[model samples]
Target: MEAGKHDRGRSGASIPGRFVAEAGLTVPRTVLIVSPYFPPSNLACVHRARHLANHLPAAGWTPIILCVDDRFYEQDPDPLLGSLVSPELEIVRVPALHARMTRRFGIGDLSLRAWSALSSRAADLLSARRIDAVLITGSPFYPMLMSRWIEPKFGVPVVLDFQDPWVSAWGADQKPLSKAGLSHQLALRLEGPALRKARFVTSVSTRQNEELAARHSWLDASRMAALPIGGDPGDLDLLRAMPDIRRSRLDPAMINLSYVGTALPRSHGLFRVLFKGLAEMRARQPGLAARLRLHFIGTSNQANDSETFSILPLAEAEGVADLVAEIPRRLAYAEALGLMARSHGLLLVGSDEAHYTASKIYPALLTKRPYLSLFHRLSSAHALLAAAGGGIHFSFTDANGLAGLPQDIAAGLERLALDPASLGQPRQDHLEPFSARAIAGSYAAIFDGLR
Candidate 1:
């Protein structure tokens, strides 16, 4: 029922009823959204973020976003995506120094100038504003920690969006800043205490949530929500029905197994194993290499940055020659999904060492295309695909004690080659919940509650 109706109550004409109705409609709480990446910066960073800020007011809370200006990020800002934000809410953009610092230093690590300036700016912003609540996105977790500095100054409730498993995210062979460890002490100094004081904590997935919950017991599980990274409906609309590249005459009879997203240096060895397996395919079926298109969607630091910047040479040495094509980030997603639908199969790689989840796995589901995943056997991707009954997976580490890495990939490819026809059909039931609007509504609900 609509509020503020002229209802007949026991007290005739219901004057008090009108007053009660007026009292029921409370003013929307102004929420401050702290994020480093907002689109059309087009960084694959925040799928959940845009949804939250754009949908929040619809759910009742007023979103006041404080983020790095898109122009500051070394990329063109999409006015179209920015238009999604309601003019009713305030969006505060501060030009950041990180991107420039990254261009100078070759990586997006903390710069003393950038770090000090932002930390100070964040403190100043908090001090000047009256925010009912603050939702901080981690990455530049530094900005989130600003809440700690200003929380005492202004008693505002804060939410820490630790979107990924931090601290534990040290790359393999990247020695801990310290062992016994002053660096461990210092690194934790940045993330620890601020998160400890947070009113609530959230991560993108249940696995990430468990990792956080294991450390901070005060994080209410009820408050925890799996904010699955989402694809734009516009992105999804790009999903097109195309003939299997392996089946089509234009592509020729070749197995096109595509992997979208970065094949980081640490993870390159895993793909190397697959490449080695392809070598086997080459040895047995000589023409397989010509037909085999192992498309790597998204830029590599090697391609995008360059460095000790190894992996490509190593991949070539292993014999997956001319196989690795590093496509630009812009064409990776929706186009890749369509490619997945038409390719013989999609290959998913995750860390077998850690209980990691690949964000690319979800988009593959939308394709109705079968994916062959290699990583931890019990991964969520494997489970989701198994439930949908359209994907296959095995642990590369477990099968051959990591010995048959490439050979295993080759063997798996051969197996997939056996049945080029996949049970390709959209899992509409599964896709329904993941629709951008649905996810956006849940975000709206979270924002509504904040009000």
Candidate 2:
């Protein structure tokens, strides 16, 4: 149970030793990873690259990260995140056009602003080194375009990793001339060219891979990898070691349940369902509900936008406003974990999209506290949480399966408020499959096949 040792004998543990070439020379293959939002910038997408780079060496790939300098990020940087990065990794930071300079023009994506500098720097490294592959992870989907550009000139295979679906059906209901509609159209125009020369495409779930395959007839199952960004035990270990970081937000004396991360647009229905359950709990078990406090932290997508709150309004609508507390502004990476660690339990609400995967579940599982997870029945997250055991999981379909959702949520909240110990800990054997090291091994397999 050492810090950073989540996979001592678990499945998908890294293979020990260096890779050998046909000439019997022992050396790890090099991969240049294009990650525009890297550490110190506490955006969730950074963990995908951070964890991959931290563990890829054991899987026989040396990663050189190409990222935007932290100075350009509009969000306040987290120094703690910088400490979590592997000291051995090589990180190259290039200049990007600051948001201040581009906000007037309505161009805010860091990848778009950093495109020229990143591409030029990448070309220099490719020409100078023996790089075996290029992996561009996105949400700043614009950088994936480098795949189409890089492979042709450098003769290196490229992998485009998506933290989310590039072209989504989420905004289909918006007006044609609206911002969401315009963005969707632009994604439709760009995705094809970005993927035009990629040797392989990767996403967080199999459902997402299927979406990609369906969108592009040329993309087959064999050309894709579904790799979830599972939790890093090292994060918990680091949180435990940092004495300065404290859970000042919640009271230990009160029965508190925390929900962290941004609440998506499609998750509003789920929130209403959860709030209704709270209202039901208040009616049926007022005394128990009085002791329970439901917290929603970082519910807004914009980190510093305290004015934009998503969960509280719904809680007010359900008449459970007294029971619910929301902090729309984002917390630093470690501080968020500290709040979770001190809480009596965790709460996870899923999107209506079945393909949506909640990456936060991995870390919550590591916390060993009781969690109430409400997800679409077909979501990859629901399946993962159910298989691991311990948590209270309620799955619903978009249509008829939701009739009983409020009662289920009410019952789950009662157990969490009264007899939390009955929920037990997630089985270690079951949890190992979603560990960060295991995820890195999966990525290594896909990289090996491409080369």
Candidate 3:
């Protein structure tokens, strides 16, 4: 809700809603952040809300996080992540249909389970508080429909933040009656109306914004912004303080290179190229290959499912299984960061989609260790690495572009195995623009303009 000239606190004295450091403008506004997956749930998408809530206060906005209660979450809760949320932040958790009940009906998406609950709570908050804006983020893309629903009743503007594409041809090959295809069809029907009424839109990459614009011709270029979910240096600090958390998965005796995150189904081709390169390295430089160990941790997005392995099968097919270890179960957020922190080097593989930007690059950059990224030439991650002077990036255009990948991967592996320091550290100056604080300022700027 938009604040008046000032707002009254619990003591009933007037408090400035917003304080501009330079212009001395005191226009405090309240923004409700509707994110289904939040802290303790430990899904990576939660950080977008977590970091924003912590820093938005400085930008003259008081953020209220509206999330589903962690108890109803399908993923295992990580207590360490809960500790990282700011004490000052206002978080309201709402109940959702329990996953067990929903799972029986083949309806496990959090957005579907919690949409009515979120809608009810959001209406209550808007009615009670002086809310100026509503920012709805999605993985549970259904909540974004509230953008159209809330504004009409509450008289507040809404912004839709896309962490991933709501509508895409990603699973087009699936039978139309299948769950994935049905969801895609539903998205096709729903996304346009949900977006049409939004005050503005924002995404993590320029390509996503561009795609949204192309799909909905009415969306103007100025109505959208592309900003990465930058890393929080405080996360590293908190990670260091938690000694008992499983920190490093890399072997100290080996030349450890780690890739920590879910290996998407679309990323199979990228892995094929990478493993083929490793196979070549093993054949050409047996001694160095023996010493090098590549760790693909948390390759499965599903929690507590160790039986299914994404990278292991690929590695075996490429005949480099000995050099690669695939841990399919998801890891705690801090543990993932710790693995990157302790690694001799990091491995970043991008998706087949040119528009896909790996937001994990921000945290990887914060680790200060060299990262060798295999991405499309147009991927924002490639540009980010270049701008930050972080590490080596191998960009491919098409099937033909990947023809040299095996050789490139072989060379990169050899270099990291022998003279890792030659890659040099990422420049901190260039990285400053991508801090969590700066990202909040950018979000605030968009919020400030909508009013």
Q: Write down the lDDT that model 2 would get.
A: 0.85
Local accuracy of candidate 2 as per-residue lDDT tens digits, 219-298: 86888878888998888866765566365689767899999989998888888988998999889999988888999998
Better of 1 and 2 by lDDT: 2
Model 2 lDDT at residue 167: 87
Model 1: residues with Cα > 4 Å off, grouped in runs:
1-25, 57-62, 75-90, 98-131, 149-153, 169-173, 176-185, 217-223, 237-255, 299-303, 306-311, 326-344, 396-412, 415-420, 441-451
Model 1 local distance difference test score: 0.58
Tens digit per residue, CA lDDT, model 1, 85-160: 4344455555545456555754453323245545555566567754567788766466666656555667776777
Candidate 3 — which pairs collide?
1-130, 1-131, 1-132, 2-131, 2-132, 17-28, 18-28
For model 3, the run of ten residues with the poorest summed lDDT: 1-10
| Best of the two (1, 3) by TM-score | 3
Model 1 clash pairs are 273-405, 273-406, 277-406, 277-410
The better-scoring model by lDDT among 2 and 3 is 2
Q: For model 3, how does the per-residue alpha-carbon lDDT over 1-451 read when each residue is reduced to its tens digit? A: 1111111233543223484343564445888999999988888889899888888887778888888887789889988887888665677787788889989999999978887788888998899887888999987789998878788888899999988888865856568999999988888899899998899998888998888888889998998999888888888875675675465466678999999888987788999999999999889999989999999888887678887888988999999899998888888888888888889899999888878888788888888888788988888888878777657778898888876789988898888778878889888888777889999999989998986
Task: Please give the TM-score that candidate 2 achieves against the real structure.
Answer: 0.94
Ranking of predictions according to lDDT:
2, 3, 1
Task: Give TM per candidate.
Answer: 0.74, 0.94, 0.94
- Higher-TM-score candidate of 1 and 2: 2
lDDT of 3: 0.84
